[model samples]
Target: MILVTGGTGLVGAHLLYRLASEDREIRAIYRTHSSLHKVLEVFTYYTTTEKAEHLFKKIEWLEADIIDIPQLFLVFPKITEVYHCAALVSFSPRDYRKLRKVNIEGTANVVNLCIDFKVKKLCFVSSIATLGKPISDKKMITEQLNWNPETNHSDYAITKYGAEMEVWRASQEGIKTLIVNPGIIIGPGFWNKASGQLFTRIHHGLNYHFPKVTGFVGVNDVIDAMLKLMNSDNFNDRYILVSENSSFKDVMKYTANSLEKPEPKKDLQKWMIATGWIFQKIGSIFGFKRSITKSDINGLFATSYYDNSKIKSAINFNFTPIEDVIEETGHLFLKDNAK
Candidate 1:
């Protein structure tokens, strides 16, 4: 039996659809009843309504939180394989404690349960944000790069790196583990959060585009790589699952064109970002919500590249082009909004 955490999330929902289509005996955990709608919506993206409903019924849904050890303990029984995908993604400084609790402590709870249950295999979904900055000699961040604690990291990155440490400890204790650090994952659904918000912001005529470059991959590629790695003999190793390194300007332009929306015209100069961060910081003192942070300024302007050769060589894998990924996701975005 397989157990999946965060099964209602963008990656988990899509993964559940694939696993159900293959007729796998799967159990998934969700925090809320409303989130189940997301899973069905994702299934219908690839199949008929009846088929999607049927596939949705195949999952043994359980309400659990990873941070609650007793609740998480009940989830691990009879689960031979596990997919750890539940995570709190936040960049706000106010969420630092929450991020640490959920991403780091919550992952620790999951790892403990996996050990207690003697699970056969574990797959963890991590982000490239945990990867260290590329050094002067090495232009691309790879699995070989060691994290430097001295370097400033966002609260979200810090917790995820800590989570990776727990997963590494699990491998030492005899659990076969596979960790995948994916770049900005692009997919349809959940427009209010994460990468899905990129489509929303672009469609609503975002006027500024930053020049920072980072790795990107379609959601399907992420799922494909995870499934292949878990089913294979690969374990106790990490893979970077990036398809291409692209600038936000190009990505936004492509998304705009796909959505038939006005392309962002401003270059979003660093000075402008700095000025906005200053005002946002000042506004925070007066109890106003902060939409921008100090770390966000650096992230928006930094040009960091990721190397994918390791995963490609490890699995003989090929990635879908980002342009095609944006085109398809944009089509779906338009279709959903048309309703």
Candidate 2:
């Protein structure tokens, strides 16, 4: 039997679909009732509604939070493979505590449970943000670079790095582990969260574009690489799962073209970023969700790139072009929203 945490999330939902399609007996953990609907929603993206419903029925859904150790342990019986995908991604300073609680402490609990249960293999989904900053302007970040403490890292990054440490410790305790540092995952479901927000902003006619370059991968590609790695001989190692290094301007333009929206004509200057953060900070006091923050602003202007050669070499994989991903995802986004 397989146990997958965060089965309702972007990655976890897709993972569940693949596992269940293979007729694997799997238990998926979710924290809320609404998330069950989300898993079904994600499955429909890849298959017909009828087939998706069939695959969805195969999963044994369990309500559990990774941070709650006692609740987590209740679902671990008869589990051999573990996939830890629950995480909190936030750039706001106000979310610092929640970020640590979910990404760091939650992951610690998962690692402890994996060790205690003597799980055969643990696959952890982490972000590239946990990696160190670029050493030079022209060099792409690889698995070899050491994290520099002097750099200005976001609280989210710090917490993910801490979570990676916990996974590494679990590996030391004799668990066969694999970690994947995925780039921005663009997909069909949960358009309100993370990379899906890019599609939403584009559809709503966003008029500002940043000049930063970062790595991006399709959601399916991420899940594909993850499953391949877990089933392969790859163990106790981390792989960077990036399809391409694209600029925000190009990404937004492609997204706009796909959604048939107007592309952003003006570039966001550094001062504009600073002022926007100030206004967002003020909006937070009135209970408005802040979109951009100081750390996000920094990320917006940074030209961080990643080399995905390691994962490619490991699995002999080829990634879908970002343009193709954006076009397909945009169509799906429109379809889902039209209802």
Candidate 3:
């Protein structure tokens, strides 16, 4: 049997569906009141048993927290494999406590469980944010490029790096662990409400324009790569699972073009950043949920890029084109608008 953390998240839910469809016995861990949502609202989490019943049937849900070692150990009796996809994904600083608990403590708990249970394989789903410790070195980052997140600008970077460290430490202790660092994942079921909100905004022309430079990947391709790891006999190591890297302007224009919508007017991002920062400060003072943070605004607008050859060489797989991915998802979001 397989155990999955963050199984109800955007990437996790899609992974769960694929595993169930392949006839694999699976179990997932979740916490309703946990702090993971403090950052991104954990868009895919279900509030009721009835809501969760809407998905695949063969899977089991364990109401456990990643920081709770005793609860984690209780579920490891017959579990042979694990996919640690749970983490606090956010750009806002409001969720520091929850993010640390989930990302740092949660990962440590998984490592301990793996050692105790002698699990066959543990695939950790880390983020690219952890790859750049003291800011990114190259024009793009890959799996081998290791850096510390301590010097990074945001708390999200710090916590994610801490979580990934546990996996790396476990690898040295004979845990047979592998890490997959994915770019922005987009596909059919964007369970993350933030992603869903982005889609909704784009469809309604609320977020009219965007900056240039970003990374993107399709849900199918990400699933394909991860499933390959899940079934590999000796693929016990680290890999950066980034797909085609593109800029925000490029993605935005392509999405608009694909959906038969008018292209947005190009505007100076400096002014927007200044405005966003001002609002962010005000929101914090007023105890309001600031939609975006200054660090996120800076990161998005930064002229950043990454290399994908390491992943291609390791997996010998082809990535879906950015246009195709955008076109496919864009058309679907358009369809949603029609409804």
Which candidate wins on lDDT? 1
Following a full C-alpha superposition, what root-mean-square deviation does model 2 have from the true structure?
A: 2.6
Model 2 scores what on Cα lDDT? 0.85
Cα deviation at 299, candidate 2, in Å, is: 1.8
Kindly indicate the candidate among 2 and 3 with the higher TM-score. 2
* TM match of model 3 to true structure: 0.83
RMSD versus native structure for model 1: 3.1
lDDT of 1 by residue, 115-135 (tens): 989999999999998887766
- Cα lDDT computed for each candidate against the true fold: 0.88, 0.85, 0.68
Best-to-worst order by lDDT is 1, 2, 3
User: Candidate 1's error at 245, in angstroms?
Assistant: 0.2
The segments of candidate 3 whose C-alpha lies over 4 angstroms from its true place after superposition are 32-55, 133-138, 149-151, 277-288, 291-294, 336-339
Q: Compose the digit string of candidate 3's lDDT tens values, residues 38-155.
A: 2122222322334334344467777887888878888888999998988876666787898888899989999988988888889888766667632543356656667753444667
The reply for model 1, stretches above 4 Å from the true place, is: 277-292
